[model samples]
Target: MKLLWLQGLACGGNTQSFLCAENPSVSEVLEGFEILFAPSITWDRYEEEVVFHVLKEEVELDVFILEGAVGDTRRICRRDFEDVVRELAHRARYVIALGNCAVFGNIPARYSREVKGLQFRFEKRGGFLGEGFTSRAGYPVINLSGCPAHPSWLSYVLLKILNGKRLELDDLGRPKELYAHLTHHGCTRNEYFEWKVEAEELGRKEGCLFYYFGCRGPMTHSSCNRILWNGVNSKTRAGMPCVGCTEYDFPRENMFKTEHAMGVPEELPLGVSKRGYILISGIAKTFAPERLKKRLIDEG
Candidate 1:
């Protein structure tokens, strides 16, 4: 397969993440395809005219992987990038939006009106590519969304695509294998969450971050806990909140504090109703285990 990677308004965080992939390793993944263009690694190897020729359809493009926001403030620059992206997307058999920026215009989208994702802006449908757009394979944009998406997740998706397997995607175009479960699904603090034990401080290891801290694990869809970052631990496991980075409304305000209404959480878990959450929480707290309420170890 001939693979091309492009960037627009980005910080290259996803590229760093991809480079750090451990399970299959970056070289192993790249060995399966012909890398036509990768700005970070291959830009020096090829001339600008070569890239222009590829963009002009002089070469076959099997997979188009975009890793940043597309439209920016400059009308001419944005138009040029959009034109190239559209042409490549139309020619490629598969189109993959590699990170939150390319998938949903992430943090960059907040700064400029022109900055937009390849296929969707945040939760909105239309972006640089129309909502009805699809690649030559008849697949919608395959979104691997995150501030810096998990490395293994990227490798896994690529492996599946390489094997010619049809990926089942969620409504937002994320692969079901990676985004089907909530970030909290296998969280280590699940016991504390069940008992409504709030983590009073940033580094406490014995409490849930949902009650007080803005841990969006229960609602944010991603297999962070299940797959584990770096093949060992996740943010929630390391005493950090799940900031809902994979979701469209990421980088929300008050990341360390939960938003509440009348002492109840403003957003409950995926299907739990407000009344049910309140009732269940009340009952759970009333019957909270004695061991869970105390510190895990004594401080000298």
Candidate 2:
């Protein structure tokens, strides 16, 4: 299949991360799909030549992948990047939004009215492309949402398409198989969270970052802990809070501090009612195990 990749306003983190896919491996992916254009890797004098033919219907676009948000700031296809995305989306069989920027308009949309995601901006449905837009395959932009989406997730989607597997998607246009689970799943600190033990600081091996710290693992949908990054580590596992980069409400202020209302967390876990959270948390804190209460070894 022929794949054409494009970018708008971004740092190219997703491109860099996509190259690090260990399971499929970058070479394997390159071999499986004919990458017509990948800005980071393939840049010719007439860089966007394939793109022009694809737009003019001279070349067929099997898959169209956009790595960043679209906006008026960047020029492509004569005027703006959005113009190309809007046109190419109709010709491409499958359209993909490869990162938080392209899916939810992360940093770029936050600053300008012109910058926005493909189909949705933040929690709103209308973006650079209208909410009603769909590709030639009759699918909305398949979002692999993350600050820099996991390489395996992108590779998984590609492989699934290659194998002709049915991709069941959630309401958010993300594959249900991937986004159905929260980042909290398979976390090493689940026991600590279950017992209401909060990590006083970052990188404590035993404590959960959800309570005192602004860990969005409980609510954010991702397989970060399950699939793992670089096949080994994740942000929370490394003692950093999940910044909730995948969700629409990203770039939130004071990410390290959790917001509370009357001694209860303002952002409860997904599907957990506020009252339920309050009650369960109260009980869990009261009966937390002694083994978890004390540090295993004195660091003095």
Candidate 3:
């Protein structure tokens, strides 16, 4: 299981997230397999004197994980990253994209004129592994997307590989095991959502933050509430709005404001109809309880 982990124009938060893995000391767990190299832990660079065993000796790869956005400039390190990604991608049995930046070009690529995400830019949609960029080994690139992907998501993917289970990936190449559900699933504030109890304040414990605070739990994918972060809580459970970090166009303009042209959302569910959505929302709100509408002064 020789693996290579590479980073491009990244902030290294994913690295930190990987290092903080609690399910297993990720390093110790992965030690059962050989690691060809890692950017942060390895001392190799363009100027380094380490022997390129993989390139020179023809070392086959088991997995390749790419992080960060791939720049669009002709003179930038994007080429270097792309070269390594392509070379390793073609040679590896699997490729894993470990963040939103790599999956859909997160924040930097949002409004930037040039830089693009690993496999896509905003308007372009398809990224480095172009619309047709597929692995020579027959497996598609695995995308683990999140602004900062939850640690467990990474570990679970690696473990699944170790156990030889078939990973069910989505259209975007994300694992269905982790992203098949929305962040709102199993949220403690679900009752408020069902009752249409909008939270007027930022940290209210008794109301849903989606209707007013731009929480995208209704639209965004991920199991934040179902799995529970750090084993005890999640964004919605702790009174923080679900920022829709798992989605591609996260950190949109005036993020606090919901994406609505009038009173209806501009973006509906994955493929749901606007009319059906409005009808269900209307019915849900109509059955709202007065007690849920009333604000609770003491959470305790």
Candidate 4:
């Protein structure tokens, strides 16, 4: 299980989040895997000799992980990081894009054309790696997208790989085991959403954050709620809106305000029809069980 992790225009958030893994944790998972290199952890760019070996592909690798968008890291021993990533992809069996930046050419990509995701730039294919590119293992670049991808995501995939399992991937190259569920799945405010009870403000334990507060729980795909962050709570559980960090078009302009088409949400939940939503929302609101209207805590 030889692994090499590289970074480009990165914030290092994914590594930070990956360290928070409780289910097996980073150190535990790293046991079976030989870390040939990683920018923040096992390796740093200043180590010219190791970087040389990795770049030259002298050491055969099993997995190649890119932490941020593929950008000009500007002369890692007179070699561009983009060139390094493109070259390393050919040497490794499996290639993984470890965060939204690495998968979708996120925020940094907004500024420079040089910055691009491994296989996609936002909604479009053909990023740093073109549309037809695949790993030595014959798989496309697997994306584990998030502002900072959930630690469990990497840990889970690594465990599966270590166990020699045949993994399934979505069209966007994300692992099906992780991205199959919506952010709404198992959300604490689901009851409020079912009854069309929308939160009027940012922090409240009672209502759903979808309608007025711009929570993308309904439309965005992720297992955040199902796979709890830090093992206890999520954005909605703490009464903050789900900013839809997992989607292709994350960090939209109106992240905190719902975009509506004449009082109807512009983006309805995945597979939910607008007419049906209106009809259900109306009925649910009209007969909204008296219990839903009150605060969750009885402060008598």
Residue lDDT tens for model 2, 39-142: 76675635467777676665778788998888865666585667777888888888999999999898988888878888888888878778898887788889
lDDT of each: 0.86, 0.86, 0.75, 0.86
Give a tens-digit lDDT track for model 4, residues 1-300: 899887877899998998788868788988999887766667444546666877665688899899888876666757776777788898888999999999998888888887889999999998888999989888899899998899999998888888888889998999999998989998989989999988867787888988889898887778999989999999989999989888889878978888888889998998999899999999999988888888879878
Q: Any runs in candidate 2 off by more than 4 Å, and if so which?
A: 43-46, 297-300
**TM-scores of the models, in the given order?**
0.95, 0.95, 0.86, 0.96
* Cα deviation of 50, candidate 1, in Å: 3.6
Give candidates' CA RMSD values in order: 1.9, 1.6, 3.2, 1.6
Clashes of each: 0, 0, 3, 0
**Candidate 3 least-lDDT 10 residues:** 43-52
Q: Candidate 1's error at 150, in angstroms?
A: 0.8
Residue 199 in model 4: lDDT: 80
- Alpha-carbon deviation at 77 in model 2, angstroms: 4.4
**lDDT (10s digit) by residue, model 1, range 1-300:** 888887778889898899888868998988889887776767555534555778555688888889988885323223476777788798888999988999999899998778888889989997788899989888999999998898887788788878999899999999998999999999999999998888878887889999888899999988889978788999999999999989888879899888899999898888999889999999999998989978889785
Candidate rank order under lDDT: 4, 2, 1, 3
1-300: candidate 3 lDDT, tens digit per residue = 877787766888898777767757777667667766666655455411222556556677788888887665222233354565567678888788888887888876864755566556643656777766666556567888887898889888888887787888887778999999999889988888877778878776788887767788878899888878777888888887888887777767666656676787676656669888789889888988888877667555
Error of 4 at 190 (Å): 0.8
lDDT minimum window of 10 residues, candidate 1: 72-81
